[model samples]
Target: MSQQDPSAAPHDDRPRGDPWHAFGYVVSGVAFYGFLGWLLDRWLGTDYIVAIGIIFGAGLGIYLTFSRFNRALPPDSSHDQHEQN
Candidate 1:
């Protein structure tokens, strides 16, 4: 095998990812929370819980999307440094 080049650009092996994951997270969160809210509204006889649930779900979805797709990363250093080499 040929020896690897030393001066070549670093290989970004990380997956570039897709927008669908975030969409799914947000959509799924809204759906799940909305369903829960409907149930709660039925049981508690409160009409506002559905709206609150939707808002909460949106926020939760964004948080989860960031926490997940944003990548936990190799370490805190990864935040500051993009180039591994």
Candidate 2:
């Protein structure tokens, strides 16, 4: 059996999450807000149009960003990459 060197540093093997999920979430949120705001404007007869859309879209974007950040997993420090035995 090969022994590990005491002076050598430990390795990390962790799966990094993809960033496209965030982009997709932001895009979807924006589209949803836009559609909802338009419907609200038509129903409420508000002179100020698209303001709600901008606000909600921005808010949803921020929410998505935070959600993605929180959901992302931290890097693994263990050198164990499992394979089917």
Candidate 3:
């Protein structure tokens, strides 16, 4: 039986950081852009701009969240090529 390394990090099922962080990003994006669109619609007397803004905001939020969180993750070492050699 091999002993566990004391310096190894503990395994966790959940990713680090506030669970609401991603949700907040998406909600804030939608609210902000939707509000902007609503104001634009009022100013320009248009009907569909608010809907467009909401869709755009949601897409932007998802992209932003993906870029922010996905890039920060460390590459998996379990498949490290050098270790197999």
Per-residue alpha-carbon lDDT of model 1 for 8-84, expressed as tens digits? 64545444567887888889889989889989999999898988888889889989788776664454555347665
Off by over 4 Å in 3: 1-17, 72-85
Error of 3 at 6 (Å): 7.7
Candidate 3 on 10-42: residue-level lDDT in tens? 454445555487788888889989999999999
Model 2 per-residue lDDT tens digits across residues 1-85: 9998975665433324567766776777778887788788889887455577867887888786776566654554443343322
Looking at model 3, residue 31 earns an lDDT score of: 93
- Provide TM-scores for the models: 0.67, 0.52, 0.65
Q: Give, for candidate 3, the lowest lDDT window spanning 10 residues.
A: 10-19
Candidate 1 segments whose C-alpha is farther than 4 A from its true place: 1-15, 75-85
Q: List the residue pairs that clash in candidate 1.
A: none
Worst 10 residues of 1 by lDDT: 71-80
Error of 2 at 52 (Å): 1.8
